[model samples]
Target: MSSPTRVYVSRLAGLPVYAPNGDQVGKVRDVVAMLRQGTQPPRVLGLVVEAFARRRIFVPMTRVTSVDIGHVITTGLVNVRRFEQRTTEVLVLAEMLDRTVTVVDSETTAVVFDMAMEQWRTRDWVLSKVAVREGAKRFRRRGQSHVLDWAEVSGFAQVEEGQGATHILAAFESMRPADLAAVLHDLSSKRRNEIAAALNDERLADVLEELPEDDQVEILAGLDTERAADVLEEMSPDDAADLIAELPTDTAERLLTLMEPDEAEDVRRLLTYEERTAGGLMTSEPVILPADATVADALANVRNAELSPALAAMIYVVRPPLETPTGRFIGAGHIQRLLREPPSELVSAVLDTDLDGLRPDDSLQAVAKYLATYNLVSAPVLDDEGRLIGAVTVDDVLDHLLPEDWREPDKPEEDHHAS
Candidate 1:
């Protein structure tokens, strides 16, 4: 292999992994290593490459022909199986960064910010150096930085308890919630909980929704009841309800009680329906406006950064009591139509009343057919009294239509193919 003698593992993160023919394959998410006994540096195992469909697979270090700041060149062959960390393996980025270690010479404890690995013999690569930061001196605002041989640090071999997530979070701060969820899924339970606790309520809530049900329940259980409720409040009502449904009945009720009454009410209403029904899949919160609201108002509501594209594609026009289970549903206005109308024109003028809204009890198949037949991204779910209750998006329908274990890792492919 032809590559740099040494490269910091942190710097390799997110670097594109390409095939020998210059075709882009995946991006490096993390470096795996096998820790050896005594003071010997850990042997580099492979690169965790996140490929199409957010599938993370392992690329053995031997398959890598070159490594640089811009990209990693692989020999075009890699296992398509989901990368499952074995008992003796470790994810360098997820586990090692931010670890507190002691500098042998000074006997001072410092936090690991990054570590470098170097090619050893013909094909083997091993962790070689570590970069650490010492506590700030009195009156100093910053800590001292140091880079030493792997042998000079003393805590890598032992399992960390209460390890901080500062460096890891900072390194991947730009990752989307879904990508961050994938990273969290691959971490040890202890490490995962530690990172979850460090995240703010809104951030954690977004991440939790992207995670699998079991992981979401586990992380929520790890948090205090008050904080858990706060996090639940941040999640979308539909997602929050689904996660809460997975918990023990008593635990779920306790957390719901701790949440704000309004938020809890929305989740409670969602919980009333079967999990696969329109009511269960819909988000209680959507772009809702009174009939008198203008095109400008509708536009602004849909422009909310928090609103998903499907949810923003249509605005619900309803009577007074502008919350979920609102007063009589008037009609829905397509965003495309609203854009063509005069800004001062009332949203009611362009409403699409041809299609009656879906009922909460509507089956998942019925919901799917409704959206597909009309070519709509979202449709309103109404109550028996004709009040607008929630809006189910195409994405929600797709989620339910896919296999129940769609989010879980897939079994290894029968054949390994080169790009």
Candidate 2:
């Protein structure tokens, strides 16, 4: 027989699968690998086929007679049931691409952008090599490319069944939310949803807010209704409202009802605002307290790590009935002002009421000028009654200022270098 054909998983996917009699059987949907063997390289198990009737089934490697860049020929026998993986099996594209892994020989880390497979004999295929683009950030550098023998890659193949998500979470635990979202956007939809589902609500919310609007909607749509609502609640009201506005009316209404009442109310109020106004960009929750609150209270609020430095740099003071539609806006006090006073001193004593508070309908240009004129990162938004309503954060304003598609990466299509 001629030398066995070699191909990559990316090339194999979507190729038509044929039977021994020259009959078309199905198309390749994914390649499955058994990871029970030692970590150097896992055993190639089978092909997940999308056959007639739109059904998905598994054809064991033993039944695969030949595989080439253009086609796969099977033994004309395949199990027609839906492909359910045993604990030892993994779907290559779903679980592996964009995965951070280490090269054993060089001890360098890289992501698996594509994998090469070698057909050693009739019906015998094995993972042969990995094609990785070496760079810490995808957009920051057009990194060097390297092809390494499959044995040189260590981390991913060694992980046990059901551990892929765990490993992925640990790999990205230290990444900034924006960076994490960028990585997620580069992955296949299947891999993207898997990582998104594994993340906790707060972390997921932060990542969601950092993603572009379409990505934010896609991630939310992948989640179950209740879990999606919970994540929405974890997001700032303005962010949540922006996402909800992109969803269909019925889906948006259902998710809103599922959210906690107060959280839903905040998002609902934000949704009513025009997109370019202060009201549209401001967060309903800010570090606000009564004018009589002590300097110690302001310090405690600022010290909370969850608040962004911009929001934490100052505190808003209001009169009695300090709530959303709060009592009259008394003034704002910066953290520097708070620290100079005694812990027992009230915010009312040092508050600077001279600065102009933003109105909900203030133009984006007006809001920008206000922040620039005062050198403030966050400015309070007040109503006709002078009740404190929200705070426009600089980050939100920057989002508007940046070009559309600013969050998208500039890379060309993924590489297709098969062995």
Candidate 3:
């Protein structure tokens, strides 16, 4: 009599499946290879399951009747429920916040799939010549399956890393979609959102900023009003103004109605200026302290508000009669100079009399020169009445003037495998 057939994942393709009652079930999609502990054909972990009536399922190897390429024959539809549940829900690559994964051959030990990860991880990529001997080859082939071997690769590992981390990198780079998305998180919001929009939404999102303003407007117009409004509401004020200004007035008005009152007001105010002005690009959320407050009080507010010294710019003293006839307000030097002193120190002592000011209508070129002349990261924008309506940071200035939308280019690519 013929000996019982032995099965392997590589050889499984179109195997026939059957139900518990012996009725022919469906065709085998593939042999699902699983990562195994040391020394056993990865435990015949799973199979590339298919069904006649439902979508494909990853039937465990335990229930598999045979696994021959083109034929991953299996028995039992009853026990595949646990894992099948995941397949039903949308899987976002961004949601794998805590699943450990390995990436291989890059500037970072984590494979250089995305530029941001490479920069953030900051580890070297390591590679070695593979010497697959007869005995060694069996373990690589038998119990554990290697995804992409450097030996099989045509290019070099750009950076080097520790031996163990290197191995991990290799394993993750070649992992399956279900398993890969099981990890690959811990990236930034922009990175994660890009991955989500590409993957499953797990719920949905995207960044239209990278695209041209025209493209951003074009795409937003196509989305349902609700979703388009969400994208607009989510955008930075500068980006929002740039986009909404490009839209037809009716479209812009419709979206404005849907946005939060304050945020909508901010966008409307920003859009009022020409796209190339301090008033057009400045963020209105500058941290302003009343002039009478002590340095300590200001420091406390700074910490509590989480205002960046660089972003908030110089704190203005709004007390009575230092300069204004109305005893209105006057500005001072940057906080970095006074922060070393105790917070209890008086504000009058820290105020800088020789501060520069910009009117709302000042051109971006004028603002850029003023900031560069003073080596300033941020400058306060005062209304005609001398009220600080907003503040401009170097980043905001650069982001507006610069041709491209600037984000970390090293960030990971959008995940396309979630659903």
- Residue 11 of candidate 1: its Cα lDDT? 83
Error of 2 at 149 (Å): 12
Q: State the lDDT at 238 in candidate 3.
A: 62
Q: Which stretches of candidate 3 lie over 4 Å from their true place?
A: 1-224, 227-236, 304-309, 319-328, 404-419
lDDT of each: 0.90, 0.79, 0.49
- Cα deviation at 147, candidate 2, in Å, is 22
What are the models' TM-scores?
Answer: 0.93, 0.63, 0.46
Per-residue lDDT tens digits for candidate 1, residues 116-201, read 99997666899999999987656745678989998898988787799999888877887889999988987879999999998999
Q: Which tens-of-lDDT digit does each residue in 309-382 have in candidate 2? A: 88898799998777677998999998887889999999889998996799999988889989999999999999
Descending-lDDT candidate ranking:
1, 2, 3
Off by over 4 Å in 2: 1-164, 412-419
Which prediction has the highest lDDT against the true structure? 1
Q: Write the per-residue lDDT of candidate 3 for residues 208-249, one digit (tens) a residue.
A: 644445445555654678767776666666667788888899
